[model samples]
Target: MKIVIAGGHGKIALRLTRQLAGRGDSVLGIVRNPRHVADVERAGGEAVVLDLEHAGVDEVAATLAGADVAVFSAGSGNAATAARRDRMDRAAVVLVMDAAEQAGVRRFLHVSSINVGCADDPGIGEGYAVYLQAKRAAEQHIFDRDKLDWTVLRPGVLADGDGDGTVELTAGNPIAPKRARFDQVAREDVAAVLVELIDRPGTAGRIYVVVGGDTPIEKAIDV
Candidate 1:
C-alpha cells in the first residue's frame, strides 16, 4: 500500500513508518523540519518536507495525490502552549482533511488521545483543557464529513516500553466496556494498531480506544 503521513518525525508516526516500509509498503512521510528528514528516511520512509501548520491546501493536496491513505499524526508535542494547541491540533488536522478530499485520498487514519471528548472547558483554566478542546474540535471536523473513509484510534497515556504485539482495543466510547486497563499504551503498539486498521476495511468509520492487551494485534482489531 502507498501511504502519506503527516508528522513523519513524530514518535508514533516514525514507528508506523518503520512497520509499513519494513514490510515493503511505499511510504511518504511529511515532515516540517528538514533536519528530521534524514531520521524519517532512516526509518524506511521517503521524506517530504512541508510544514502542515503553515502550508496551503493546494500545496498539501499536491503532495497527497495518488496515495492510498492519509494519516494525521502531527502535533505540537506535549509541551505546546495553549494557543498553539488550537493551531496545530485543530487547524492543521482540518487543513489536511480538506487536502485529502481534494487529492482524492479517501482513507484517513486519525491518531488521537484516549479520553478525548467534548470539553467541559467553559470556564476552566487553559492547562489540560486546551489540548482536550483542540482534539475534540479536530475529531468533530472529521466526523461531520462524509467525503472521507475515516478511522480514529484513541490510545491511552503513552509509555516508552517496547510493544509486546498485543493490544486490547474497544470500539465506540472509551468507557463503554470494562475490559482492559486502558491507562497507558506503548507507542509501538499504537503503531501496530494503525497498520492493522489500514488492512481492515471493516474498521472504517469506527473509533477505538486501545491499550496494551493479552491478545495479539491481529486478533484484537476485528470490527
Candidate 2:
C-alpha cells in the first residue's frame, strides 16, 4: 500500500516510515525541512517538502495524489506555546483532512493524545487541559466528517523502550489509574501499529488507544 505521512521528520513519524518501508510498502513523507529528505530516504521513504499549516487544500491534495492512506502525526512539541500548538496541532489537522478528501484518500489515521477526554483530575493540570482542548477540537472535526474512512489512535504517555507491540486498547472511555510509562514501547512499536491499521480493514471508523505490552502488535490491535 502507498502511504503518505505528514510530519515525517517527527520522532514517531520517522519510526513509522522505516517500519512501512522495510515491509516493502511505498511510503511518502511530507516534511517541512529539506534537510529531512536524506533521513527519510535513509529510512526507505521518499520525502516531499510541504508545510501543512500554510499549504492550501489543492496543493496538499496534489501532493497526496495516488496515495492510498494518509496519517497525521504532526505536532508542535512541548516547547510550543498554546497558540502555536493550536495552530499546528488543531488547524493543521483540519487542513490535512480537507486535502485528503479532495485527493480521494479515504483511509486516514490521526495520532492523537491520550490526555484528551481525561476526567477532571488534578493530575491533568492547566497546561495539559489546554492541550486536551486542542486535541478534542481536532478529533471532533474528524468525527463530524463522514465522507472519509477515519480512525483515531490515542496513545498513552510515550515511552522509549523495547516494544514487543503488546498494549491495551479501549474503544470509549477507557482509563487507567496511573499513567502508562512512556518508556514502555519503543517508537518502532508505535509505527508497527500504524502500519497494521493501514493494512487492516476492520479498524476503520474506530478509536483506539495504543501502548506497549508483552503481546505482539497484531494482538494488541485486536484488543
Candidate 3:
C-alpha cells in the first residue's frame, strides 16, 4: 500500500512511517521543514515539504496522487496559542479531507483525541475543551462526508513505553477510575492499530478508543 502521512515529523507519525516502511509499504510524508527529509528517508519513506495549514488543494491532491491512504496526524505544537491550534488542528483537517477527495484517495484515517466524546466529566475542560471541540468538528466533517472510507482513532493518553503491540479497544466511553492510571497506550501500539485499520474494511466509519491491554493489537480489535 502507498500511504501518505500528514505532519510526518510528528512522533506518532514517524512511528507509523517506520512500521509501514519496514513492512515494504511505500510511504510518503508531508512535512513543512526540509530538515525532516533525511529523517523520513532514514525511516524508509520519502518526504515532501508542504504546509497543511495553507497549501493549495490542487497541489496537495497532486502530491497525494497514487497514494492508497492518507493519514492526518498534524497538530499545532504545544507552544502554539489557542487560535493557532484551531487553525492547524481544525482547519488543517478540513483541508486534508478536501485534498483527499480531489486526489481520489478513499481511505482516510484521523488521529483524534479521546476527549472529543467525553461525558460530563470535570477532568476535561478549559484548554483541553478547546482542543476537544476542534477535534470533534474535524471528525464530524469527515464522518458526514460521503464516498470516503474514514475511521477515527481516539487513543487515550499517549506514552513512550516499548511497543509491546498490545492494545485495548472499546466501542464507547471506558474511562477508568481517577486513580487507576487514566488509560495510557504506547505510541507504537497506536501506530500499529492504524496500519491494521488500513486493510480492515470492518473498521471504516467506526470511532475506536484505544489503550494498553494484555491482548495484542490485532486481537484487541476483535472487541
Say which candidate scores most in lDDT.
1
What lDDT does model 3 reach? 0.83
Tens-place lDDT per residue, model 3, 84-165, is: 7888888989888899999999999999876776523467656666676677778778778787888888888889866788
Q: What tens digits encode model 2's per-residue C-alpha lDDT throughout 1-223?
A: 8999999888788889888888899999999989999999998999999987688999889988999999999987787788978988899899999999999999899988766765344677666766767887898888888878998888777766556666665564323223423424466677788888888878888888766667677766762
Enumerate residue pairs that collide in model 2. 158-182, 159-182, 159-183, 160-183, 166-213
Ranking of all candidate structures by their TM-score, best first: 1, 3, 2
lDDT tens per residue, model 1, 1-223:
9999999999999999999999999999999899999999999999999988789999999999999999999887779998889988899999999999999999999998765653553544456568877887888888888999999888888888688999888887532232323388899999999999998878888889888778899899776
Per-model TM-score on C-alpha atoms: 0.92, 0.90, 0.91
Candidate 2 structure, TM-score to reference: 0.90
C-alpha lDDT (0 to 100) for residue 75 of candidate 1: 84
TM-score of model number 3: 0.91
Could you tell which candidate, 1 or 2, scores higher by TM-score? 1
Cα deviation at 223, candidate 2, in Å, is 8.9
lDDT-wise, the better of 2 and 3 is 3
How close to the true structure is residue 127 of candidate 2, measured as C-alpha lDDT? 66
